[model samples]
Structure formats: C-alpha cells, structure tokens
Target: MTNQQLLTKPIGIDVNQVADSSSEEATKAESSKPELNSDEGLPLLLKAIIEGFVDGVLILTTNQEWFHANECGRRMCSQISQGKLPINSIPEPIWRVCQSLIDSREWFSDRKRFLEDEIKVNKSVEFRVRVRWLTLDLSRDPYLLVTLEDQHQSTKNSAITDVINYGLSQREQEVWLLKKANFTYEEIAHQLYISINTVKKHLKKIYAKQKQLMQH
Candidate 1:
C-alpha cells in the first residue's frame, strides 16, 4: 500500500489534513497524543503506515530518547538487549551503535559486514540493519528507518571463504604459535609491538586457515 494509505488506514489519521494544519494537528492524530500528554489511538492510517513498512520504526524524542517503537523494531531491539527493552528504555550497546551512526553518517549508511562478526541478537542470531535517514515533521526532526534482516546462508558461507582467502602472514604464524602456547593476543601484540586489532586480525586469518585446511 502507499505510505499515505498505510498511515491513513491503520492510524486513522488524515496525513493531508495534518500536512495542511499545524504540528499540533498532526500530534493529535498520533496514538495517545503522546507529546501533548493526551491519550487516544494514533490515527489508524498513520499507525498502519509504520507497522506495514519492512523496516522497524522507532520514534525518538528530540533529546534522542526513545519514545515509541513498532513491533518488529521492538523485537529487534529486545533481541540484542539480552532482555526486554521497554518503551523509553535504552541499552548501552544500542546507544553506542546510535552514537556511532550519528558520528559517521556515511559509514552509518553503508554498514560493513565482517566474517563471524555478524551482529548477534541475544546470543546466536545473525542480524543486519538496513537504515535510511528520515525527517518526521514540520519540526524537521531526525529519525531513522532501521530494517532488521537475517543474512542468507550463502552469504555466511562466502564470508568464511573470504576469511580463508586472506589467511595468516608469516608474522601472523609467529603470533599463532605463541597463542597456541597460551599467549593472549594482547600479550602477543605487546611482545610483537603491534596493536590489539592487528593481532586479532591476524588470529582471525589463522583461525580461518586452520578451518580451511581441516575441511580439506
């Protein structure tokens, strides 16, 4: 359905009417008239528009505080939360993710996926977010359209293959031997005078190579 149709039908709000009217008119059409502190079903059409979208909709306050969220969005947030994340409640990880997004709009728009680094929800879920920038109203407030999707099996398999392709360098092998001898990557990095991320990258390469060889 069209965005207007969805909003007008589910939330029962007249977007055009609200568009022509004041922000107060638009607020009146929302469920519970939240900002105005009044209670009522948000215009059916508006509600439907959000709920029907493939992406989860989360409305945040001007202060960047959580205001409300749709079902899919709510579930996505809860999955990563390790517990229920009620309305208005924010998790630190999510907060960090949002901050990073706001900090790097370009990076935020194009999320990079790494092998075995797929963001997991709760424990073992592989989650990816497709986001779009949104401006809600006359106030020109900023919001985001975040779509939660599961990676295809082929994608995951390909990632493993890619990691294997970039397998360990000679210096990495030296670190791996020490790691096998119970040295932490940090300790190895310290001894090798390398950064922790570099050490981890090397180990990832080592791990993928070992898996590849074993498969052969």
Candidate 2:
C-alpha cells in the first residue's frame, strides 16, 4: 500500500477515547469506595477502564497470580491455553517476562517502568505484550497490567498483504507494513536502514502501483 493509504486506513480502536473514558470511570469508582484502596478495590476500578481497550488485558498481583482478565484476554487465553483456566493460561514466554518484572526491585522503585516484547503464538499468529506498573490507589499497593495485541490483526486490512499479492518488491512490502503500523517516515527509514529520501522514493512507487491497481 502507499504510505498515504496506509496512514489513512482506519485501525478500529481509538486509544485516546478509551483512556479518557477509563480514567473517568475509575474516578467515579474511587469516589464510591474512598477507603477501599486494596487490590480488591483496584480491580473494580481497572475493570471499568480496561474493558474499553481493544487489547487483551490481565491484571496481575504482586505474586504473579491473575487478579482479572478482560473478555478479550479470556478469549486469547482460551486459544493459547488449550482449556486451561484463564488464571493459569499465561504462555510460558510471557509468563517468564512477567516473573522477571515481578522479581525486579526496579519495577517497584520506578513508578513508570514499562516492559514490552513480541511473542509468536504459532507460525501465523504473533502478539505484542506490554507490561506496565500501575498504582491505582495511593492507599493500596501497585499492580502489573499486562496488555496483548495481535500484531497481524492490526495489519489485516492494510495493504501489506495486498503489496505481497500484487508482486511488489520485498523492500516495498516491508515499507508498507511499517507504514501500516503507524511508523513515521523517519522511523521507517531508520528501521529499514535507508535514507529518508529513499523511503519517500519507495512510497512514490508504491502509490503509483496502488493507483494503477485501482484503475483496473
């Protein structure tokens, strides 16, 4: 796909809107239970907020136990866990990273520590996992929020696959994929180890090809 087309394509989730709504709901939940600042109350606040996120979300305790899983999270776990309970269904690679974060003192000391990694569910499916430390309430301890996104799902509607199907060059397809992922021009150039001008040149060719295909 052309860089412009990729940029303009809808990705189906408005993250800012979700964040705003979640924050507002959390505020209301907090006000209702002013003294309930433990992990018990924290999940209630998070549940309302995270339900709006497209990603699969899991709230984990300090000991790595699962406190809650959103609907998307539960669905993802069912696919990966092969009938295991959602609480015990964390994939090993993801679990290992979660364990390390839980064990690290830095996670507790640094209030804003964020960890991200990419894991393959199979040869076809891959997910980007993000772990962030959150202090939902000052009266209670912090918790780990794990978010998962199916990387392939995000690009399914974009022109990455179309570029490949249309017999575009490998470099062109790579550029399309990165652009579809919302990479800036400079970021795409850096990732592909090409000059910005080269990236622009690629996009021009891609745009022409896409236009040509559309005409037919």
Candidate 3:
C-alpha cells in the first residue's frame, strides 16, 4: 500500500514512511549521497534507523521469535534477563506484555493495537515496555514492534544533553544532575563534598546558562 493509504488507517505512524522521510531529508542535506536499491536497501535503512534510537527496538514475529533487535535492545534484553537467557531470547517480563497484546489482537480483533506496561526491577530501575502491531503487508500476519525504555537512563540522557546544549561547566553539570534527581541543596553539597553555599552557587550559574541558551 502507498504511504497515503497506510496513513489513512489508525495504526499509528508508519515505520516505512518514517524511514523514507528520513532518507529524503538526509539526501537533501547531502546531495552527493549514493542511491539505495529500493527492495534490499529499505530494510537495511529501517534497521539503521532503529539502531540509532536511544530506546531499545525489537521487531518480533507473533510467536515471539526475534526478527530484528538493535544493540540497545540486546543490552536491555540482557539486563531484563539478568544475563541468564540466550542472547536472542526475549526476557519473560517483556514477552509477557507482548503476549498480552497478541491475545488482545486475537480476542478483540482490531479494538486494540497498542499496549504499554512498566516493569520495575527495583526502586531505581524500570523499563517502559510498549508493544504495537506492525503491518508491513496486508496479506501477511502483522509483527510486533516492542520498545524497551530504561526510565532512569532516559532521564539521565536528557539531562546530559541539556547540560551540553546549555554549555554547563563541569562542576555545574554535576550539581545540575543532582538537582534534577530531586536532591536537596544540602544533599547535593554533601554528595559533591562542598558547602551548601557552593551548591547554590553552581545551581545559580547553571540556571543562568540554561536561560541564556533558551533566549537565543
């Protein structure tokens, strides 16, 4: 089906369309980019796109067989499995969510196409698992696109990105991270082995840098 036809459906964003759009944008940015052979190249492009994601991306068959998983996805699977399962196997916790989605598809038909579940290993570690149907061909059974997001890791990554964008100093970045984690001024000072006055000073500078960046 054409992208227009695919968009007309309620199946959420089309991965193929995203890949195509991204490729077009890249080509515009770099006119000298070599052309890709449509059939084989598209799948490779899709895999590359998935690999670039910060969150874990897994494309699996209905029976839970792994069709494709990026490096982040593999690492997360190992974490969820506690390094006990084979490298290619999906962790039981994640598979449970995928199975629930599969069951929903079978019993409720198209009533549900997306499902999300949060699995917590402890107070500080958790994964936001999202499963959705991915239909590449109308004639074939739809596959599952499972994304595993490490909540803590994602938060830290966002904070780090902001630190760079705002041009935070080394000391200011350390203070900023502690502050973002909900640490009290005193706690931040203790963690950084500095006086509370020093902690406040770093935060003031960090805020000023962020404000300056935002105004531009």
Candidate 4:
C-alpha cells in the first residue's frame, strides 16, 4: 500500500449472504465446519465497510481463506493468496507483521495474545499492522481481523475505562473520579459527607499515587 493510501478504514458477519459461500470454502480444506456467521444484515454492512476502506482491512476466514479484502488489504493477502503477486506476496514490512502473529500462535497453540508491529515502509511512511482474533463456531478455526495504517497518525483507538486504574483504595478512587469530573474539594466534601480537610488529604494521596504511577 502507498503512504497516501494508508490513511483510511467492523466485525459482524452475514448469516445468509455468506452462509453458502462460507460452506463452500469450508469444504475446500476437506473439513466439516459449522458456519461462523454474523447476523445476516449486520455482516453485509460490515463487509461493505471493510471493503470500502482505503486503509488495509482484511477478514480471515475460519479456515484461513480470504473472506474479504479492500484494495489496501490485497497488499498483505499474500500470507495465503498463493502466487498472485500482492495477494501472493506481502510487503516486507507487513510480512513481519503477519509472521509475529503466526509465530505467537505456533508458540502457544491454546493461549492467544494480540500481535502488532510498527514497520518502516519508507522514509516518509511507516505502517502499523495489527491483528485481532475473533470467535468462531463448532467445526471451524478462529478468524482474524487485520488492519494496517500509516505512521503519520494512528487510526486505532485506545479503549478508555470508566474507572481510573490505580493502587488507590475504593474511596480514594471515588475521590479521584470526582476531582477529575471537575468537582471542587469543598463540593466533594459535601457530597461524600466528609470534612474538607479529609477531602484534601485524599486528594493529596491520590496525586501521590498518580505520581508514583507516572514514575514507574
């Protein structure tokens, strides 16, 4: 994929639209696999979105066959795309990205962890490759969602938790969240029905804990 192409980019699978086709591919490997279909309507939308992506978006089938690929995704489809050039051959950077995932799977066949790589595509472009495995039904192998992005900016979103992570106690966390929500010390004191001094003390300790976390 070109640097300019890595700028743009769903999980559901279609039950009916994909069922017959999935069964056929499932048979290609001489396996009796139950379908891992997403709801009919949702996956159709998903497939459309995935294929419409300018960024690389690929859906690995339960049998590791190519289920869907956008223009950018075709670049790395080589992992199984045979000798069809881009599909048959992956970019060197993306090759390592895929290798990490395959290696992790080989190391711990049962346990799984997400695999990722930030690879230099060119002097002007770096790419971040990410692969996430998904659930599958009986008689099938698990599938993967693969994405590629240019380094200028990351498209992947980091999940934010409602609760702040800390070694702080439950009450301390409560105080911290309140403070984060822009509650004043005196307001928090009234809400918790604690003395203003106690609120200040908790805030002090919370700041200390956060500082400690930052240090580590």
Candidate 5:
C-alpha cells in the first residue's frame, strides 16, 4: 500500500497447492463459508493487485454475507447504500441479482452462471453491476464475484478514447483529461506537476490535433 512497493511481480494462484494442503473435509466445511479476510486468506500480493483495480471487486457468500471488497468496491457499495457508513451488508438492488443467481443455480448446479443488473440513481447517474459464481475448490460451493463499474467514469474513459483516436500524445491525453474536467491551466499544471506554460503548450497541441481530426 505504499509507493515503495513495486507492482512488477507476476501474480498467480496455485489452486493445486492450496487444495492439496487442506483435507477434503476441511475444504468442504470451509467452502460453506470461506474466509473473506485478505490478510488471512489471500496472498498479500493478490490483495494489493485487487486493491489497485479501477473497478470495484466484491466477493460474497451465497447467503449474501460480506466477504471481501476492494476499496473501490466498498465505495460503490456505500454509494449504492445511500452513503451508509461501514458497508457490512450488500445493497438490496445488487442483492436481488445474487438472489436470482442463487435461485437459478438450484435448477442448473453444474453450469457456471452469472447475472447482470444496473442501478440508476437518476437520469444521469448509474452503476453497472455484474455477479457470478467463483469456485476455489471443486467440492466446495462457489462464492459470488460482483463487479461494479461507475458509468460516470466510463463516460470519461470513452472521452479519453476519442482523445486517443484524435492522435494526442500521452502527455496531451493527460492534459486533455484535466481540461475536459474543466481544470484551469494553473490547476492542470499544479495537478500534473508541470509549469503553467507547459500546460498551455500541451493544450495548444491538443487543439491542433482535434482541428486536424475534424478536417479529415
């Protein structure tokens, strides 16, 4: 969780190693309620990688109990819960998908299943939610992996895609993102740790690229 930590390490989960280490009975019992604490149950490296994800990642039991959630996941859960602090429970709208998935699993237990839903806050704001079963052991029940994506951030990403298509350089793309967010030149410079004149230079180049794209 610090800059001193390097993220270049390859991450992999050895399911065979984990499964071989535990007894069948233990795996079966633990599968009924797997440990959600990343510190105790998951590798520190895996936890760090999950935390670094832009989208929210949540793991929940079939009974809808809280298991583990990355930071973005918790934030989205709070937002869905209407700014409720200490999101120890799942939101009703999201839980509906889980409930549906669980009920459907009764009829099709052998197949991998996933469900999707969207939560609308208003006309302009919404979150895309997807839920699916995550199985660690063959003999155990699968936990639910719910991914939450913010539509607002998705819109920003789409805009960035357009900036890329317009042939903006990497620095120009960064400058354009801040500019699109309505940051002043001084603010953009401060945010990027660059001189104000450099910000203007980037903007000037960005505008030229946009103009050229329009002409084409």
Candidate 6:
C-alpha cells in the first residue's frame, strides 16, 4: 500500500467494540491486522510527517554538506540562497555557528549543546533557528539537525502573558508557564525548543525576580 493508504489505516482496534465479544472472538479479531507495507512505507511516512512540520527541518553532515531537507527547509534554503543549495549558500551567521560547533569537536562528547538564535531571511523577514547535534552510529555519518521557525510568530499563551505581568522577560515567562504546567526542566526545554542549560538560566532569573517581588 501507498504511504497515504498506510497513514489512513486505523491505528488500533476499539476496545469498546470488543467489550461485548467473547474472549476467543476478541482474540481472533485482534489477530486480524491491517496489511502494511512496513519496509518500504515507513520511510515515506516519516518523510511526510517531517515535511508537514511548520518549522523547517534540515540535516547537514559534519562537513557542512546538505544531507536532507524537508519542504519547509527547502523554502528556508531558497530564501537564503536564491534557489541554490550549496554549502556556502547558507546564511553567514548560521554557517559560522555550525562551523564553530564542528571545530570544537566537543559536541561529539557533549551532544546536548543545542544552539538557538535568529537569522534574517530577507529585508523584511527573519527566522529563529535551533541547531542540535544528532549522535548516530559513526558508520552512518553524523549530522546536525536544524529547525527554523518564523520569528514573527507568537509562541506565547495566556499563561505566559500572566507571567509577563509579573515582570519576567519573554523567555522567563515561557519557562514559568511551562513550570506551572508541571513540566520537568528537560521537558520544558524540549517544548520551548531551547537547551536544558538555557532552561535553567531562565528558571534562575525567574526565581530571582519572584523572590524580589516577594520581599516587597
């Protein structure tokens, strides 16, 4: 079956439908599985899901060569390179950051070193970029994953706005809101698209600010 067909297939059987059935009947029903072209279809399904992401997904080799790019990533590359896809075609600031990481060689050991910054896509547009090192098997060739989000978009919610009223910076507000939601520090970092160290920094600032307010 095609990727679309595989995606449209029911994910799991309904428990309610089997609630009234005999144990043997339910077992027989569970044994009946949908035909999936797993070997060939899985990659296509993954590609479709990655391409569907709003943030651009880009993969590059340690040497800075383009390895893969989703649809959104291609659009970002086009904006930066004017339809070209060469190594030098990437915006200078982004390339420099990537080069620095590659040069340090520390990322191989400290793979959690994720970088986040902004890059101007054009005279009127800019994008927030997040870069992370992906540790794959040495033989598979290591790659860096870059995700780009439009800077103009608002990631804030009402909870974040409430935190902002308490005199926190936007980043701090994000951290506070996630903390209020009971998200762990690592989960907050992942959800906010920031590094764990950055999350700690935000929390530190937030605590200091909150303590100062409490003293008043």
Task: Tell me the whole-model lDDT of each prediction, alpha carbons only.
Answer: 0.53, 0.66, 0.75, 0.57, 0.74, 0.63
Worst 10 residues of 5 by lDDT: 1-10
Which residue pairs collide, candidate 5?
none
| TM-score, one value per model | 0.41, 0.53, 0.66, 0.41, 0.60, 0.47
Point out where model 6 deviates above 4 Å: 1-42, 82-89, 154-216
Error of 5 at 147 (Å): 0.4
Better of 4 and 6 by TM-score: 6
Model 1, 32-59: lDDT tens per residue? 4323322323445566676886545665
lDDT computed for candidate 1: 0.53
Highest lDDT against the true fold, candidate: 3
In the range 104-124, model 2's lDDT, one tens digit per residue, is 555354443556777766744
Q: Where does candidate 5 stray beyond 4 Å? A: 1-40, 167-216
True-structure RMSD for candidate 4: 14.8
- Model 6 collision count: 0
lDDT of 4 by residue, 29-100 (tens): 445333433543124455676778766876564344555567766753443333445443444555555555
Predicted structure 5, TM vs. truth: 0.60
10 residues in a row with least lDDT, candidate 3: 1-10
- Report the error of model 5 at residue 52, Å: 1.4
> Relative to the unseen true structure, what is the C-alpha lDDT of residue 197 in candidate 1, on a scale of 0 to 100?
94
Ranking by lDDT: 3, 5, 2, 6, 4, 1
Candidate 4 deviant stretches above 4 angstroms: 1-43, 52-54, 61-65, 75-88, 106-112, 136-139, 153-216
Candidate 6 residue lDDT tens string, 1-216: 111101111112222233337888887766653333354222344457778898888767777676667887778767766655664256565666666656655534545455666777663456777666654332244577778886544333455655865688777877887776557989999998999999998888877877887788
Name model 2 segments beyond 4 Å from true: 1-46, 84-88, 106-108, 160-216
User: Least accurate stretch of 10 residues (summed lDDT) in model 1?
Assistant: 1-10
Taking the tens digit of each residue's C-alpha lDDT, what string does model 5 give over 53-90?
99999978887788778999988888888876465779
Q: Report residue 207 deviation for candidate 1 (angstroms).
A: 28
